[model samples]
Target: MWFRRDLRLGDNPALLAAAADGAEVVPLFVVDPTFATAGTPRRALLHDCLVALDTSLRETGGIGLVIRHGDPGDVVPAIADELDATSVVVSRDYAPYGRRRDAGVADSLADHDRTLRGVGSPYAVDPGQVRKGDGDTYSVFTPFSKVWRRTGWQHPHPAPGDDVRWVGAGSTGVVSDPLGERPVAGCTLPEAGEGAALDRWRRFIDTSGASDGSSRSAVAAYDDLRDRPDLTGTSRLSPDLKWGTVHPRTLLADLDASGSGEEGHTVFSSELAWRDFYADVLFRQPHSAWENLNPKLDTIEVDTGKQGEEKFARWCAGNTGFGIVDAGMRQLLATGWMHNRVRMITASFLVKDLHLPWQWGARWFMDHLVDGDLASNNHGWQWAAGTGTDAAPYFRVFNPTLQQERYDPDGAYVERWVEDPSEPMLDHRVERTEALRRLKAVTGR
Candidate 1:
């Protein structure tokens, strides 16, 4: 069984089928150098998840995960050849790199007369699956969301039946560092493995008090609280979902059973749908990962000179004079994640104020965030650049001062991360006007 993003075993279609096929599964994870070169904080988190997975496999009386460091295209086939395996199975991945890499592996395996099988993705509704009646993709979020909710999803599969016997891949004499020995600074990552995911879900639903009354009621207030940076209003499940620690289908099923009303449930469900929407957008248009999504806007000017670089460096270093923008940047540096609302504001500042291209910000996020997904990060940057489907138009710039006044009215969130923070300055209006003028000059808008 090849493990990609789908780390956990329960509700894992590929892992379940692999175990059921009664093949001595040489559970494998290839640590691609490409991932290491990217060097995000999430890299450490991924390593931690692998350690947890190895532990789980050990408890199942298997040889634990086989860790190989190389290009997956080269290593996967070599490993398969060494094991003399009949087939390789994995959950489908939609990212451009994943798609191309998997194809290379498939072609290599075919040369060895081994079959490569792919199960459906972790998503309840695969990207591009829910489409308009005319078989075209939906560009707008509302209609896409409406169809997504009406779409059918598969039920969670049970853990593989114990009747399946293992055919162990003989010792390759490779030893991996124990999970307990890995050192990470100040990372309180969630437990890794199928059991951990289930346990977390149980704790959330049972203790959260959302299940007691109505499902819709519990999440109905989410729309309001989700925007509050200081509150734990939104579900802290993005990292879990990103790593496939929990299946999206399972989450949707739970929400459905809660009988949450349409409005609240719909809003919550739309966030989930955004995941697929971005994936499909990226899958169909990989170039958008580095360029503007809308070609006509490719001419949108940005500063890439020494001054621009210095400003971008300050933005990344969380030294921006604006309290709210700096706060969001610092939060990401400290915790490897940022709230969605702040993400928009910070992105706007980078592109509009600093006049840096969206790709620069996207790359920075990818190198830091635990929940940094290619589709989400790239599409999000394009949206902020006003060059993507359903984008915030370019003219709709986010005024950092006004935004802070509106969202962080008390300056609580800003104060939390800003160095030696004070109340909004008495001459803040004058400062904001000057800042806006600088931005207009730099962006030529």
Candidate 2:
């Protein structure tokens, strides 16, 4: 079984498919050099997860995971040839790059009369599955989310049985560390591996709310507290989901069992729905990953000159002089993670306040964020920039001071990340008017 995003053994459809005929399953992970562009926190986490997966495999009476480094198209077929394997099983990938990579691999495998079998996907419901009566994709979030919830998903697959056999790829030893000797980022990272993911999920969902003698689970309180940056209100499950340490179905199942009808659970489910919504959007319109999904919004002027570059550098270095924006940027720098609310505030400031293109901020985020998934991160920046599906209106520029006051009332979150914030880079009043003027010029509104 070839592993890409899906790292865990449990609830893995491709793994089960690989072992269906009682064949010796080779747990292989190809280290593509392209992934090196991801932030150090992500690479370090991947390394840790690989180690954890190997330990799990050994304990389950399987040989260790095979590590091969190269382009997967070349490496996968070569390995299959070496093992005389008839087919390669994998979880379907919907992202543009992944789709292209898989297509190339399949073509190579076909030349050798081998099959490339794709089973389940990382998402609970694959992209393009949910649609309107006319079979068209929804450009707005509300209707898309409503249909997504209705479409639902099947129960997660069970882990492979003990009868499944594992074989090591030690004989064809060309294995090399994908990350090489590069240094990981200095910031603290979340614990890696399947076990850690499950533990964290349990803590977040509080299967038994009474476990901690609290009347409500974290999911129950999620609605009220999710917007507050000062509290750990949101589930810190993004990285886990990104790496596929835990499946979305597992979380959904837990919610269903714990009374999903409750407001808190309902809100949390909607958050999950947003994830699916974004994936579907990206799948249907791949170019939106970099270009604006709403082409009409493309007319809005964006700064890309030396002044813009200087401002971008300040924003990245967390010296933007906006308290909440600075805090969010610094938090990303320090932990490779930033609160969701702050992400919007920072993004809005970049696009509206600084008059910079959302792509500039999006690229920076992809380079630094541990949980940065292409579909989510780029679309999120576009959403904040008023240039994506269900985008926030261009006139709705976020005032960092008001946002800081409303979300971080105690100023605790700001204090934690911004020990010494600089003066305001640009006046919000002036910028907000300018942003609106630009929008008017484009839309004649």
Candidate 2 weakest lDDT stretch, 10 residues: 170-179
Prediction 2 global C-alpha lDDT: 0.86
Over 1-445, each residue of candidate 2 has an lDDT whose tens digit, in order, gives: 8988889999888999999978978889998889877778788877878878878887774467888889998999999998888999999999999999999999999999999999988887899998899898888989887887888888888988899977764434424344355347667889988999999988888743422245678787888888998888888899889989988988888785333487878888888888888898899999999999888988788889999999999999999898899999999999999999999999999999999999989999988888889999998998999888765877788989999999999999999998887788788999999999999999999
TM-score of 1: 0.87
Clashing pairs in 1: 24-167, 215-260, 216-260, 216-261
lDDT of 1 by residue, 1-445 (tens): 8888888767888977777646666678878768755535677777777877777766664657777778989988987887787888899998889999999999999999987788878577887698888899887777877787778688887765555454432345444433333435243455555567766655544434343243433465566667777655566677778788788788777665233555545567778888878887887788878877777666655778998798788889787778888899989888888989899998988877676888999998888787888888889888887778765877667888888898778888888988665443224445335445654554566
Candidate 1 wrongly placed segments (more than 4 Å): 167-196, 207-220, 257-262, 422-445
The per-model lDDT (C-alpha) reads 0.74, 0.86
The root-mean-square deviation over C-alpha atoms between each candidate and the true structure, in angstroms, is 3.9, 2.3
What TM-score does candidate 2 get on C-alpha atoms?
A: 0.95
